[model samples]
Target: MISATLGIEIERGVRKLLDEAGTSWPSELKVLVDRPAHPDHGEYSTNVSMLLAKTLRKSPMEIANKLKSELEHAKIAEGIFSKIEAVAPGFLNFAIDWNVWLNRHREYSAYQGETEKGKVVIEHTSINPNKSAHIGHLRNSCIGDTLARLLSRAGREVEIHNYIDDLGNQLADTVVGILHTKTEGEHVRFGDFCWDTYAKVNKVYKGSPELQEERTRVLHELEEGTSSTAWIGRLTAEKIVREQLHEMKAFGIGYDVLVWESRIVAEGLWEAAFEHLQATGAFYKVEEGKLAGCWVLRHGGEGSGEAEGTPSPDPEAHQADKVLVRSNGILTYTAKDIAYHLWKFGLLSQDFTYMPFADGVWSTDSQGQAMPFGRGETVINVIDYRQEYPQAMVKLALEALGYKEQAARLLHVSYGVVSLSPETAESLGVDTSAGKGSYAMSGRQGVGIKVAELLQVMEESIESKRSRQEGLSSREIAAAAIRYYLLKYHLQTEVVFDLRQATEVSGNSGVYLLYAYARAGSVLEKAGAGQKGSGKALMEPPVPSFDGGALEPPERQLLKQIAYWTETMDAAVRQLAPNLICSYAFELSLLFNNFYGACPILKGPDDRVELRVWLTWKFRETLGKALDVLGLPAPDRM
Candidate 1:
């Protein structure tokens, strides 16, 4: 980022001079740079000289020669570069002042102050409480938690949220099966015990119209919030959901708000939103036709010229008319969701007072209670790719209400669903059909592995390895290693949960990067507390005086990479891709490895040795900061 920002500064300086030339030229002069593909070409190179060569009607070499004089005259890289020169291809390259660059690196990292404050909401790890957490859920939590950490680190007010759909047919089938049938009080922990039962019920419903009717009836009971079956559904859901949230917390996934469907109904938030829809003329009367008994909103009041061109049935046709009033004169799920989202954005016509959830069984803070609803400048929903459309509809409804800005902020962080390899499915003690019913995770059938147990296993492995190798204070090691593993992958990736790959020290794993840090720390420690660094071990700096004349190309390349980190971070935030930072951190490790192999830190007591010590320490500090951003810890020992 320093490199790029410097380029901008230099351009502004050069452009001003051009404007003063006062020729009949374009009002704004353009400056261009194409960073070197290899460090051998210098840190950054530009062919802008050649571009102007043709316009100035001179050979590129001559123009480049002219430009070098003009640029040097500008003194942009004054203390930052050793030289600014022209390469054979008419490329202009600037070599930064090595001491200045080193000093900048030290000062830059020390400036990471406290987190800023402003309301921010991040929704993740919202795996259906009905089932256990799986690898997909793992990705969501890793990303969501890491995002919060990054934003919080950069200084923002952040609140985490998880939405649970406790009232639905998916939960009902399980409750119905449990109600009529009796099981030993022994709870089968396939998520909500009743929810797991739904999967079993779905499987063998064959040739039994009676069972089919029962499921349909149960779903109705769920929707209407009536019958003994509905009560069981609610109880089982609240229990299982809380446990799953606790499991997610091991990896630092905790939400401040827990919004549930039942509460939305109890408050009648949807009914008010429906009234607003009617007032806004967004809902219509379905007088007659196949949908006669039901109401429907024609896409655009007529029909989508085809919501695409499949000439497909309105996906919402089979769906209720979004039925604010079902044929039975009650709200449907679609209507409820529309209303809930409006309330989420505080756009609903009527407000619902927060009732601190009773039972105290599931909430946030010490008492296990969550922050009551109605907050957040923006809401992000992390869901499986399949739910993309419904989530989009939530945003669409907000957009329809003339809250385009909020709708724009209504992000759906849709990700690929997790599915295990056939071999893994069998290993987990289950027969998995490639498709019929075998999928990543399904709360419906009560299938999938546990996420918390996975993290615990990973933690134990790391702890045991350290216990045998070296003594690191437990907190430092745990925080660093756990985050490193979770952040190694980018979000939106649906990895086939592979245990062997997760804990490996090499092969692109977080452990390997930590190993690198540990090695660097050992070298620094052996050099003694007073060895060219602050003995306090606090990462504070005056200015580093490294001699760049001894820096190999790889060392220079490493410096260049370090310089772009702020830019990489800004890009990561803008693109919503955690992997960019993840990949960059690893690449930095690789650079350090090469630099260390070629340049020894503890081997010399000469001026160069002290310089190498300074250089290595600077590298470690920068790498450490980048790792922290990725939710990874920098270990003092491998």
Candidate 2:
């Protein structure tokens, strides 16, 4: 909030300087405020003067000086900035008045982000309804759930969707295995049984052409939605999807609606999409080639979206055409996805019927009451980076269909894959000698750690550590550890799953944050809760005035960290990066611990003690808010 406030003031000051000189400026001027690394320079610095130097034909230092003078004389700058200086080359540095900074905390202790108009639909954790979820799926769910929380907390209406690819090849394989090879017997967890059956079917398909033919047959029946085989596939997909939902719920992930891939096909959504694609010339028939009789959507390279019948310079260029509908009349996943996204942006006139799946959850049904879903102004698909090309094609389809604005609003929030660490892989009985870095899990090989299995290990590890504290349950600890581990890495960074590292309480982990929160609570408890309703009185200004002179070096550093809470959140939301919040929380925790060691809160001088208690309260509130945004539960004691 300080950054936003300063940004506005700085822009106004620059405009005033230009107005005084009677000089023209760019219509759109971007002013950025960054916290300086060293305290001596200033609390915040800007390089806008340098950015404008070349355009204005003036020396950078001259522009910075003029801007600084204007800022000093500005009416809004009174009592806000203690000092404004022009540093070398062209940097405008500002030091906030200590009293003013404290006053901001008192004035707005609970800052909610400004509300925005329109809805955002985020589709994530779209696992195939075939087997149990693995660590890879957990990464998708955690990232997506945190993103939803961040956007919603920032005052954006967000709808979380979990797409169930029930009619895909994975489920088809499971169905084939169940109908042909497996015995008719009851299983405790149907998803677990399907997991093994899925792997076995993949192996059989590799060796037996006859079994592969059966798999293809099962796929067709599943798509047609008729016969016993289709009925079995539906039942199996529903069962597996339920298990996946349960696993995600354990991690505090929930969905606003379930978009079934089968329903997208059954309701003729893809048929409508195909008609639109043909109408827009988004795809063409490949005549007299290897892909003859197939409808292909152009991806990249030559002969792509040129004259319809234009011959490629190289016949090999035809490979760029991704087959949408095969000669055999089978629709590819990309084809259905185009339809799904079209429906997402409300471009399609049709909509799916919805039924209550759970208390605040809805699922698509053939004959059910309709409800408001989809029709989003923006759509974000939180999928792994491996599917980048597929997602790109979906956007391309939108653009080719003349929905250019809708295409712009469609974002693929891609992240790197979650792989097994060499040690963890070996621990899982997987041979790591063949691989050098992290080993990517193969579902067909049945070699990935299930979400359930990982949770079990994390819960057991936390239970062992709970001998020292009773503030958090084993389940709470497990959720915190898993969520933190998955979110701590940058979006492009691949997470190498390791149980030991995830469960560790020391260093940038969720467990560390928990202990930090608990420490603040313990300090507040020792301070005797600070006079009832005196909570607001603890803040500087108008209530119990804070003695700015009593603040020590560590206390100032702590306040600086606390001041960045909203600024950090704004950046995280803008960049769609949840790891920013994680990093901020970790850094804030370190600063608080340092401050705790350097400044005694309870036993210090009376004035310093009261000031430190207020600082403690501020830190606790800020850290707790960040944890909530990260979807990590805060524990009172540890």
Candidate 3:
């Protein structure tokens, strides 16, 4: 992702200058290059000369003049940079030869067909196997799927993990409520039944302390593992989680590994984990205070309260620790997670007997058929941000246990939740006092819309649009539009869940982007196809020399945006945010729209036709790549 071509030249200039100055350094001296915020400030600017001014005891301007003079004498300076100019603030600005952009355009365009398998561990849609898939789950999967696609395209080995919370308080509640309610012959999906049972039980327990106590009692039984209640509880949870996974697959979400909480607990991983922590001098017993009888981990932190240069509350704070094993000798939730994290990094000498739940949920193969189960090399946990502390603690514990490298490898990829629609919130009588503000979805009392129902609405909207749209197959139009809308927006923002806007078949919706691709498809059909006819025949054209002579302002801008593909892929990988890619797609779409409106691809006859056709096909290919990164399908008809 070279931001500018002249940057490569400028780095060489700086390297030669540094060597000439007899300054020994480590690695390549990285001079930060950027496109200046103001167009008047030239295409690319660097502040390295200014940065060295203080050490050199010379004015930045004096240093800049020397580099400007030296860089002009460099071999690669020809055609890459038209002129080198210095600003009053000691910054160096370089004007680029637009021909260099044409070269970048061709370079990036080659990556379109590049196949990949380089490995990535993507953990997403880790919905607590307690209830149904809500809007928040949708957000997680959409972002995760898009990221997986981008990484795979950029050539990465991707392994998806869908973790289910198989043992917890919610599991107990659903088991108690659903088991009592279900009749002898109900053929309900576990998640669907859990959804109904959870909502009903939640509705009752919210106002009644007695009902709440009953739910807690069931949880204790599950924890204690003695009562028959525990048996039914675990089974009910397993079934429900299975149903949720099934629906997730229906909406194009799949995971290579399906990790469960119950199996780890059964294997005594937590017991072994507790011993590891104790041996590392990271744990001690809490003999006093409210935490009596608890085996707590030492906890302290840096703040104003701590002495200067000392971590306050210190890792030695209270001379006590966080309780790894709780008062009743029952393990806390944190303990289980610690064991799981250790196993993820292969630090734990423990293993789970991998069993197929056969819950009827499966991942896809290369041929669009079902491919079930895969072993993973890395693990990601997609949980709510509140768990960031717990996750951090897991990392800290790993480091304490001397798995410092493993600690560094863990990623807590958090995203804000999708909120309830305002009217839905009002209709459901949502409590504004939860302090989570709007990002709360209460599955109990039936507060949230199911993902299936939401998709159904989208599908119907697609059908309605298809019926009205002329000369297009219903299936093609419906799918293209739906997938595009799903991929169009940034996933980090808390979507307001506007049912109307989500279902609306036009304007920045996924369908609209698909329509744009479809429109490009129509143009290609009219011209007897663009890429296969010319791209294959063009013979890579000696680094694709373009005159910039025929490039309109719009064409230049489009080319400029097109050149950002490498950055988009790299940025998304580093940041772990698909929103970055989504933003790129939107920008690319807007650029293509303007280019299509202003410049005619086939207007000029003869040689111009092939070049413009090549450009048009390139645009389609680039646009198609953008959509592909988002896992949005590019249908020819739509």
Residue range 487-554, candidate 2, lDDT tens digits: 99999999888767877878988988888988987888778755336333222212235656456789
lDDT scores in order = 0.62, 0.83, 0.64
Clashes of 3: 13
Please name the candidate that would achieve the greatest lDDT relative to the true structure. Answer: 2
Model 1, span 1-638: residue lDDT tens: 44555567556644553455543334444666656786766666777666655455667777677667766666665456678788877878876676676656645344343332446677777555555666666777777777776666656677776766766656666666666544344554646355446566676466556877786777667666777777777777777776776666555455666667776776677767666666443365554445545543333421344432232244445343343455544455566677767776667655544334332323422233233455557766666677776666666666656677888877777666666655656766656654433346555455665565556566676666664655454434554454555555556665565555565556466766776776776676665524444434434323446567766676676776777676667666666667787888888888878888987766765665666565566667777877776666666655
Error of 3 at 503 (Å): 2.9
C-alpha-based local distance difference test score of model 3: 0.64
State TM-scores per candidate. Answer: 0.79, 0.92, 0.81
Evaluated with TM-score, which candidate comes out highest? 2
Q: Compose the digit string of candidate 3's lDDT tens values, residues 132-211.
A: 77766777787777777866776667777676665677676787566544423352455666777877776666666777
List pairs with backbone clashes in candidate 2. Answer: none
lDDT at residue 509 of model 3 (Cα atoms): 62
- Cα error, candidate 3, residue 64 (Å): 4.5
Superposed on all Cα atoms, the candidates' RMSDs to the truth, in angstroms, are 5.7, 3.2, 5.9
Residue 190, candidate 3: alpha-carbon lDDT: 54
Q: Rank the candidates by TM-score, best first.
A: 2, 3, 1
